[model samples]
Target: MKINLRKSLICINQQKLIAIFLVFMFLGFTLAKPEFASSYSINNILCTMALYGIASLGMTLVILTGGTDLSAGSVMALSGVIGAGLLGKAFSAANPVSLPFAATVLIALIFSGLIGYLNGIVITKLKIAPFVATLAMMSIARGLVYVVADSVVQGVSGSPITFMNDGYSLLGQGKIGAVPVQFIVYVILFLIVFVFLKYTRTGRSIYTVGGNIDTAKLAGIKTNKIIVLTYTVSSILVGISGLILVGRLSSASTVAAKGYELDFITAVALGGTSVAGGRGSVIGTLLGTAFLAVLNNGLDIVNVKSFYQYLIKGLILVFAVCADLFMNKRVKKS
Candidate 1:
């Protein structure tokens, strides 16, 4: 009983530490820029968090399964361009097809899921490393984005596809009272995932697979299936993010969401998810996403240079990774 109680306390303390760090970060930023604590700025941070938080949730699942999806950014761009092109508006491109918003979104998500399925198949059936398989898919997906854009977009080969649809725009711009719709959606997703990971059999299998694939196989868990499922879910979530991004900007560029995978991975890592896999929670991810959102917004509010921001973010990622490795080593020693 004492051991169990101690374990619970440790878990609580870990979460508390993250919360305390966030408080300090908020206070520090507000001190640097008084306007940082304004309602508008706070709302802006939540909106940004929602946009990236959805994708980061997916990344959390993938990392928990001992895998990574380098193709996420490309998938986001591809999904956005595909969905926007289907809208068939006479903005930047003159698409001929005007499907219903729901249909367009479904088709784009299906395509992204297919890409993820392929990535999973390559990693599992072909016995390729997750990194190599996803790296290839990243290139392939980005190429497809360019191909899709060139085929639909009217102007230059690399032009952005722009459109305006009220129904579609609501996903990004709609607000209830003072809260952004996207942020609400993000919270809903976080709750659903948190419950799923904590309560579902398949979710439990994912952790087992990540913890030890050989042991999982011995225990009759279909490791490959879990990996594939994670990849598929990750891609679908990224597709949703892509659609939201397109709605937010009213444009789909070939370069949309470039390098976003790094941000997603960073958030997951900062949330204390193991890079080697098996242990983490959606709650931590939510806090990590909020931290990033606040950090970026605060830096912008303070008029920090882009280069410094990049450097600072990079250092934070490095520290998080090192801390993770250190903890893992200590656990093994114990």
Candidate 2:
């Protein structure tokens, strides 16, 4: 009875500790800068988080299945530019065609999903390690962005430049009452992914495949399908992120959102998700994102230089992975 009571106490304490950490972060920032907690600031950071969070959702899926995607940032740029092109005539300062906004969004999402599908084909059919495959895809994607842009498409308002700023701005910036649209989109996305992972057989198979593909196959799981799906999902989410990024910047640059794959992976790993796969959570990813958002927003509020942000961001990723590995070992021992 004493042993049982002690174990229960330990578990409860652990839960409380995690909760406290999250609360501290929110409150810490709120106190540090009162404006930090304001609706506008909160919404702005959340809006950005939601976009990256979408990409991270796909990345989290891929990582859980024990794979990596280095091309995500590049894919985002490629697909974002495509979405911009689709809105070619929207940039006119004089007048613009509204062209059903929903249609524009759907088109961008499908373009992103299609890119993911191609990634799936390469990894599953070519039998290449995800790292190598995604790396090659990254280069190819980046090159495509340049080729497509050709130094600038010049279509939106006579230049394919201001698509996000002028065209589908609603997706990222438009507000529903007091709340930004991104918050609603992210909440819906989060619920869907959380339910899928918790309740679906195929979702369970992702863990199995990642944990041990050979064993998963012996147990009748289609490992290749799972792997393909993983990359495809990552592609689609990253694509969504690209669209948001383009919107936020109000323009798609071949240089837009370059080098963000590491940021997504870091956010996942920091959320206490495993770098090795077969283990992770949506909650964890969300927490990781919040942490990053707070850090970035805080730094900006305090007037930190953008260059410092780059360095600090890298350190944070490294530390998060280290923390994950350390925590995993502790859990195993317990």
Clashing pairs in 1: none
lDDT of 2 by residue, 228-328 (tens): 87777778778878877777777777777778998898778778777788887877888777777778887787677999988877876675556545655
Model 1 lDDT per residue over 1-334, tens place: 9977865554433334556668998999999889999999999999899989999999999999999989999999999999988888738566678888898899999999999889888999998999989999999999999999988887788789888888668988888889988888888888888888889999899899889999999999999998998899889988989998998888899999989998898888788887799988888888889888988999899999999998988886676556546655654575
Question: Which has the greatest TM-score?
Answer: 1
In terms of lDDT, the poorest run of 10 residues in model 2 is 90-99
Superposed by TM-score, candidate 2 places the C-alpha of residue 52 at a distance from the truth, in angstroms, of 1.1
Winner by lDDT: 1
Clashing pairs in 2: 154-159, 155-159, 155-160, 156-159, 156-160, 165-250
Off by over 4 Å in 2: 1-19, 90-103, 151-160, 164-167, 307-311, 318-334
Error of 2 at 295 (Å): 1.0
